[model samples]
Target: MPSGGSTLNAENSGNHTLPSTLAGVDPLSQFLTGPRAQAAFTLRVTMDPPFAIDVQDQAALTVIAAIQGGAWIIAAGTDPQFLAAGQAATVRGPAPYVVADAPDRAATVVIGPGQSCRTPAGDHVDVTMSHGVRSWGNSPDGDTVLLIGTYQSSAAAGQLAVSALPPLAVFDTQETDPALLGLIEREMSRPAPGQESALDRALDLLLLHLVRASVDRADAAGPSWATGTRDPVVARALEVLHAEPASAWTVAELAKRAHVSRATMASRFQAAVGQPPMTYLAAWRLALAADRLASSTATTAAIAQDVGYSSAFAFSAAFSRAYGVSPTGYRRAAEVS
Candidate 1:
């Protein structure tokens, strides 16, 4: 709850407070927090009709909101999903996709890795198409206007949450908050101090809302962990795990804390979350460790202990097995990137 980025260790863990990153968070919020943005790329695009942009940037996540007109999201082997005015959609990536005025429109600009823009023949158009501050398009007053925010792979924290998304998830007008979308659009147009941080927080909120909507929709396809929060027992168990990940948690302890029999807890957790309680906790701990390794200067041993590993050797073995790289090696590679 502190303004500064201070972490509360196990001694203070009993207070049920945690670092800013994981304090009093829900299951979805804990995972969604992984995509925290830093100087994220935010853009407003105004395009004429019959326009298509071939996106191959391989961003971890992209949020596209239709401000004025609409666009069609065309992914390979899936029906095109349209975002009418006031609607938004999130696209998970590394895979290529297209946003077009119509499904059949040919792409005139190709968005390559690093957010580089070029024609299909590779003629650079990044600067040529710039409309204004954080804006891009073929025309300054194009009929169709869209607000876009992207989280590049390196900046993303929650690998587990990102991995669980469908390639493209659309949120209709009823599912989105117009005020938040307006805030993002307005913020994108302004050049001010701390604007990047402002936009980043707004984008995080947008993603959070979208993911929450997905979970609430019974017919919508969402991660099992997100849907599991609907169950009181599982939600309580998840709250304990997230709030005090460094605790020496056992299934029996979690069951006891949730006021349920161990068997009931285990079976219900598996049924709702698709993983046993202990198994999920292990993955969750490792995920927290991985995020810390990339974002902090903490020693591996410290991070291991913070994530509930008994020893550095044990943490290293488990981390290596899960990530295919030792902690030091992973840290080194993260630095290079």
Candidate 2:
């Protein structure tokens, strides 16, 4: 794979209803404002000849939905991979790559990101990206259109501060994933007035589902994040922790609740959940803390207390260490994402 974006033919993407703009403007952007974290920035790139996105300066994770022609993506780095339509790829770490409707065929690829992504223009469609990096289409049969959206990463998507994603990644919309595509069409076709934000939220969820599917496919064994909960005992322990992350829960207590010896609990817990019991507890606590921070206006101290922190400073430090953002910062970023 070369350091560049990839292309997929229309055959690659499951069928999708075209997005409609209101009187030449995207009505979809209105509803995607808060950290329900949705981005609806899209472009219909109609190219006559071959084109490519040169991603050298900026690094991002993109979700590409191919709607019309045949195309594939090539990953560029020390280790590169190529993905065809109905297949998605995720790129992390720093790598230079480009996507093309290569070998003299025309196609479209939709590029989007989940958490952390930065484009020089946050709200532009179809214009050549001037930030030294760019993505485009190569046409062999006819014109091509690429739907693209880039998001800020959780690691650095705070407020107006720009951040690059951890690495370059891509996710393909499954041929069997018609339900999700139908939702996309519905969102694109919904009547405006009040349906804006809700549509964006749905799109955000759709993107999340796509990533999860890709992760599931990529795992030869099982999902790393979902490791611990399959066993009944470990699952019960997790349920207890999740149900009451704010409660004072010791590993010993969790083990007892799960009806196992502490050593066995710890071992199974790590195997199933991908982390030691205590570490998972802290991580779960921080995750819930982020949800609270994003969805409410409570004071940091109050949120800390509610999520099991003794003080605002301790909570903030833990939250930052886990999610790399202070509680306040998370709230603000949630507002913009």
Clashes of each: 1, 40
lDDT of each: 0.77, 0.45
| Cα lDDT tens digits for candidate 2, 1-337 | 1112211000011122211210111111211232334333322222444544433423334444444443334554423334443443334323445556563333232333321222334433333322112233333223543434333243221211111112344455442264654554444444455344544555455455544454344342332333343478887886765455566677788889978899988888777656677776575556545655776677887766665666777778777776677778778976775
lDDT by residue (tens digit), candidate 1, 229-249 = 889999889888777877767
lDDT (C-alpha) at residue 77 in model 2:
41
Cα error, residue 323 of model 1, in Å, equals: 1.9
What TM-score do all the candidates reach, one by one? 0.88, 0.63
Off by over 4 Å in 2: 1-34, 43-49, 55-61, 76-97, 103-146, 155-176, 185-191, 194-199, 211-223, 320-326, 329-337
Instruction: Highest TM-score: give the candidate number.
Output: 1
RMSD of each: 5.6, 12.6
